[model samples]
Target: MRTPLDSPFSPGSDTVPQVWAGRTAQLSDWRDVVRPRRLAGLPERGRTILGEAGLGKSSLVRKIAADAARRGDWVTPQLRIPSGTDPLKRVAVALLDVARQAHLATSREKRIGTLLDRVEAVAAAGVSLTLREQQGPEPYSTLTELLVEIGRAAIRRGDVMVLIHIDEVQNIASEDALSQLLVALGDALTHEEDVEVPGGMLIARTLPLAVYLTGLPEFADMAGARKGATFARRFRTTTLGPLGDDDLASALQPFLVEGWEISDDREGATRVFMEPEARAAIVDLSRGEPFLFQLAGEQAWYAGTGDVITRDQVIRGWGGVRSEAAAHVERILARLPSREREFLEEMAGLEPADRTLTTIARKMGLRRGSDAGPTSQRLDSVRGIITRGKPYAFRHRAVEAYLTTYWPDPPAGDAERESTSAEGIG
Candidate 1:
């Protein structure tokens, strides 16, 4: 069968993977990490997966849910809230949705009747029966209560697992609320308190319930710092690194079946995708970053002749990719505070700052009298600018290339006009 690469209608090679792979393959690896057996040993706690942006954490979570459903297991309800939403409300809405799905999935009329009856009971007991409007604060407490109710209902239905998957969990308002929710979930699962789901009476129970959270790397540190909070300890933390060579190859397999091929002429393309050099050059340049790999590969594909991607094509495609990356950096820079922006601009002026936070800070004029320590501290505080450890590399290579290469002297207006006119020929 022809795959996406075989079709002329496919998006330009530079398009994001989500546009083609859908969500399945994007998250296939996560199934092993979150398998039910792996989670069985832990007390009723939470599971947290952390990674940088574009690392596919959300894709993994969705895949886990899909896999569970395929196995006839009751997948937990997933709720993705924007960063900084109230945790309680997010939890409440997620539970309500899960309850509704469970009610619908029941095959026996009596079981369906019982599910609906419970849902109605919870709604009557002050849980908002309707889904919240998009703009309002979510009713979190209500949702937590609902989860307890659903867990009980699942127990009665013969050990069905009720999962709660929350994405971008770091954005949840205040760590306290997150802590409370975790504590509550633990208690509900272990002590059988909170929603009062009648512990021993409901057949053999394995606490067939779980919570999964995804977020940036800093989330763990932030949660760790919270005093008297054990949420960090309760969770089995999984840090997702870049896709291994085998996995990366597997991800690209679907494309190879078609006429599209990675040849030896592309810059990053051949180095990473096709060449036998120690680890692909593209991977090195990308630091094995998933989104960057896709960006680089897509550019190489679009620039190649006759659909076969060559190293030269990848090199040529770098310009386009860099342009796109620059746009992203511009947006990020636009949001920075003036002082931070100036600091970043100063660092960007250095030829090669070695990607060390200390070196970049020194270049940015961040020094205290004669001491370098204060400058380092200042840089660390500006999260938007310095990004803690590594000298803030632009999130996109294209952006770095633009700032370092194109920013000095932008294309001439006349040149741009002529280029535009030439493009009109197409």
Candidate 2:
């Protein structure tokens, strides 16, 4: 009897997998750039990660928050962007969740302590109005005061940093709301005030506080492209793309070494192997979108027998999981802006073998293929919809499959061009 252990792969959106493959660049930015700057008491800008759905944006944020929280010197409060409610109140609650994480309650700094207590009281009570009444009329203005005061208090105790993270930023109330938020963060970031230490010595220091945002690529135009210098000076947007071939291989390697447990006896480890063909199938199917890696891996694990996950097993897994995979592709495309979606649809209508940059440009109704080059590359790099291959194609095979299945029929003369071998996606 095959002892079936539950699937080890984490397949849900924003679910950090056991292996946690790829994202070297994002980690580097946090480590080399943000971490050092905050440690040195140097001012740092907010990091905004933008990508399509299933690109691991939220997972990356949560990973970083977990890292920061473990540092013992940083207070990391993470929140998902709110809709139909007071967004600032949601933020207030996130802050209150970690209020005890900072050393703000000390008796030495009465003013800072009192400030912390006031914020703690209002935020803990969940009285949105009470929190707002003490500060400026604008919620952002009130937020600025809260961040600056709390960050100052934290830094005064010891060199500490405050990292505020908000995910699903595209859902933030409105453009005006985001603009105000940027202004508020900019104000708090630049706030350098007199700090009284235990010995009554005062020092002027900038609050070691930074914000991190993640959402769809459109969010760049929302918060990253504000009308003023605040966005440019104090914030940066990093567009996340798919994992490479190596990341696919690396994610599956652990199963081999650890021996996927397959028997009722938990102590005895089954000798599990992932063939090169199995890895290739994963690379081809996932094409680097983070969630697909997990999903495909999960399916492959379930379909395999004995010890090894062979290419045939992987293909069978894909066949079994194709409908769900296509659903994921559909949802991602459904969430994209119309122009972005249309570009993908135009490409999907082409014969997969003919999906060159020039062909895509012409298909997009552009006069010259060169006109589409930058946009195509940007779509690949910024949004990860297209591949960086010579003949540019949908990055994920399921993208082509989704579009091919639902795209409108071609004109009479173009029927030959209409049919795509999207069958391989399964």
Error of 1 at 97 (Å): 2.7
Query: Could you say which candidate leads in TM-score?
Result: 2
Q: Report clashes for each candidate as comma-separated counts.
A: 18, 0
TM-score of candidate 1 relative to the true fold? 0.58
Work out how many backbone clashes candidate 1 has: 18
Clashes of 2: 0
Best by lDDT: 2
Ten residues in a row with the worst lDDT in model 1?
270-279
**Residues 69-99, model 2: lDDT tens digits:** 7776565556777664445556666665445
For model 2, state the Cα shift of residue 285 in Å: 1.5
lDDT of each: 0.51, 0.68
Tens-digit lDDT track of model 1 for 116-218: 4544443443223224343432333334445656665665565356666777776765665666556656555453422233563533333556667777655
